[model samples]
Target: MKEYKRFLLYGLVVGTVIGFYLIFNLKSFVSYENIFIDKTDFMLSSRLIIYNKTCGLQHWKEKKNFGHRDDIPFFSILSTILSSTEKKIIIIEFGANVGQFSERVLSIPHKIPYIVHSIEPVLTLFHLLRNRSRTFKKEKNDKHFHYNLAISDQSGEKPIYSPSQYGEGSTLGKAFLSNFKEIENVTVTTLPEFIKKYHIKTPISFIKIDVEGFEPEVIRGMNLSINAKIFPLFSFETGETWLDDRSVLAKEYTLKSFVEMLNYFQYDSYFIGNPYLLPISGTYWKNSFDGLRRNPNVLAILRHSQPWKNLKKLLNRIPFTSC
Candidate 1:
């Protein structure tokens, strides 16, 4: 009887510890600002000044490049487009892992008033984004905003695959590389739902999506924004393998289907680093897949946008290249 009692006691203690741990994690997951980090957070990287620390084994040596700088040209174009309009600019970034792109957008000088909704689904990465956002706030800069949830076609729970490459291959679908070792179930919210919930009244001017292979579902969730004709300029990542799977989303939202949907909305596409914008009826559709895999980041422009006309003038000053 004593032995059994001791065994029960041990089991109770172990269970209590696990329960506490889970509660703590849940609290942190819901409130990203609770674990925010700032200038005094890191011990090293003092003189040279580095950005957010990554999830790699050797954090000291990991390259801090998050492709934030690459989006500067796009922002410049948006600035020119909104030069005269008094419409409040809102930038929605779907896969804002570590807040790098958000940092670039917020840190730079803006010609017009803008707000950024930087959303990250993964709990671990969301914390990193909040920490980076806090750092930005510490500098007396306050344009960057952070959200801790996934944006999908529905608002519920979905399994997210986390690969061994840290933030490199996490996705809501199982189409990730075979080397993924962790699977996390994350809460999801749609764009219109989020906008309504947050009372965001401004029009979205730009969006950068890098959600592995989950961009199509993200697009579907933005039907409200699309139908309202507030279609924002998009910088999206595309690849052949993203649609190669037989998943329901892949089957329905195939590359051709998505392009057609964009056409229905009167969006013209262009390869970034190219001076010329591909017309809505151009032959660029045939090479979209090839361009997607090789270059990945394609710019989608609204064909009838008055701002696009002014933005096109600036593109002429820059060199054109095929992506």
Candidate 2:
């Protein structure tokens, strides 16, 4: 009888301890204050705000040759065209660093059979792109191709600077300081050569050119006549700074020159940003150019004709201004 009473006492103590533990821990789980402080206050308030704003919706978190922003207007316009049209789209991306833009392009909703051809001169970056292309191809089935070559005015490989020490696929021309070595000299070819090689007689939908400071050379190599055949859209990167040097060009390439060059092909050009038009006195250009040269960040979109009218309308719906 005494032993039974002792067992009952022991059971009561264990039950009380278990009850207290449950009350303390489980209370925190169900408490409104806990939810407010832990999940709502921290996760939603702190982390989500910056991550969603900068990376998730803004799409600027990734390390791209061009700093991140929302999707490029030209790409958005091209996606709209591809979504609407029955024609196959071919995108040739020059200086494709880690296939960031190519990945974004494939993500757009479209039924048009699209082929993305990416060219990267740097060996390490080419390997990264090759791997990414394989993964993308495995998922999508024959949608992308990667090549290791430097696109120049003529065919024949030249000295390529592979700065593996930088640890990023995309490096500004001035940022490359790694050891120089002889990489397989894949002869540079023009856009026409690419089209012929691929048997892509269809209308070329888009061409994204970003070869650091070598933009002019790539432009000169391409046959603009082919542009007439396909009405291809171009998005090239240019800056006032020469390769690997912060020293500004003596005579920098101006928007006016770019406009004149494209105008020769009857392509109307417009600068994409808050101020739709270039400033009258070129003060804006001088300041912005200097700012970007020092910081090495800034992206401007050039489109054929006023293709961004729809985009401008869309931007008006947003509460904030663009960079």
Candidate 3:
């Protein structure tokens, strides 16, 4: 009886210590993958930085060629089309992974966007994005805003799952990655609700969304904004593998829903091909998209928008087609 009593006492003490340790060090335990890479040197690079630091370990690297930058074709086309004097415009980026899209958009060189608002949910990536935005803010003061929240249909808190290998795959929906776990719970808000909460009276001019399989929910939340007179240009990831997994989101709310919504708004949708943005019409989207692999981005443009109006002229100078 005494031996059993001693065993029980030891087990109780061990369990208590473990429980406290986990509670106290929960953050460090969850971010265990950061051990492989140095956290400090991961930010924007210096012009005179000596080494690459990527010794072939990390998948991403810093772009120090902003001085002589070659912006993405889609952004370049939009910049050429939009008048340079067009101020008071806002660019909202969803699933803003470390502000890569924001950085690229702001660095477009020709037609400058008035401001860029970036939203990210992953704790580590959000911190990085907030930090990078500071540098961008320095160059273009008050033009960059960072939000550490997820954008979905409702406003509340939601658990996000992500895999260590694919940190940017953080999603409010089911994580389809092979090795994924519940990373954290992020505060969620609808796009229009967020704008109303912040009292943003300015009209949104552009939007880019890439929320893994949760694009449907994000689309549903844009009910009022979609019908506004000046429809915002959209470049979203639609045919991703996770969105069509059946277990991720319903069929009616997946790609079909996005296309239907675009059509309702009289917005033309295009497949952001390798270099060409091929238009999707009739039953093209039904047979074209192959979500199993990494699919191309989608560009939705209102036919009456300024950019679409000037697209023909820009096409002559800055060719958008590969062939």
* lDDT values for all models: 0.59, 0.50, 0.59
Q: Write the per-residue lDDT of candidate 2 for residues 1-323, one digit (tens) a residue.
A: 99999999999999999999878854533442211122466534221111012221222223222332223533644455331123556777888888888887876666567777888877777889888765553234336878877776667655554335433423223333445333434556776676688676545566777675666566667756455535345655544434454213313455445445665665544233222222112222233333233212222222322323333333222333232
Off by over 4 Å in 1: 1-74, 82-87, 137-141, 165-167, 175-177, 224-228, 244-247, 251-257, 274-281, 288-291, 319-323
Predicted structure with the largest lDDT when compared to the true one: 3
Better of 2 and 3 by TM-score: 3
- lDDT (Cα, tens digit) per residue for candidate 3, span 128-204: 99888766533343377888898988899988877663456776665345566778889999888888887664456
By lDDT rank, best first, the candidates go 3, 1, 2
* Candidate 2: Cα lDDT at 57: 21
Stretches of candidate 2 exceeding 4 Å from the true structure: 1-78, 82-86, 137-142, 163-184, 240-252, 272-323
Candidate with best TM-score: 3
Tens digit of lDDT per residue, candidate 1, span 1-323? 99999999999999999999868844532342212222473334111111111121122123221122344445544455542224456788988889777776676665456677898888788888888787763233336678878887889988777665455557777643565555677889887888889887645677787777777777777883444355546767666546546135745664556666776776665434212233222443453344234424556666646545555444323332212
Report lDDT (Cα) of residue 315, candidate 2. 28
Better of 1 and 2 by lDDT: 1
Backbone clashes, each candidate = 0, 2, 0
Which residue pairs does candidate 3 place in steric collision?
none
* TM-score, predicted candidate 2 vs. hidden true structure: 0.57
What TM-score goes with each of the models? 0.66, 0.57, 0.67
Error of 2 at 113 (Å): 2.7
lDDT of 1: 0.59
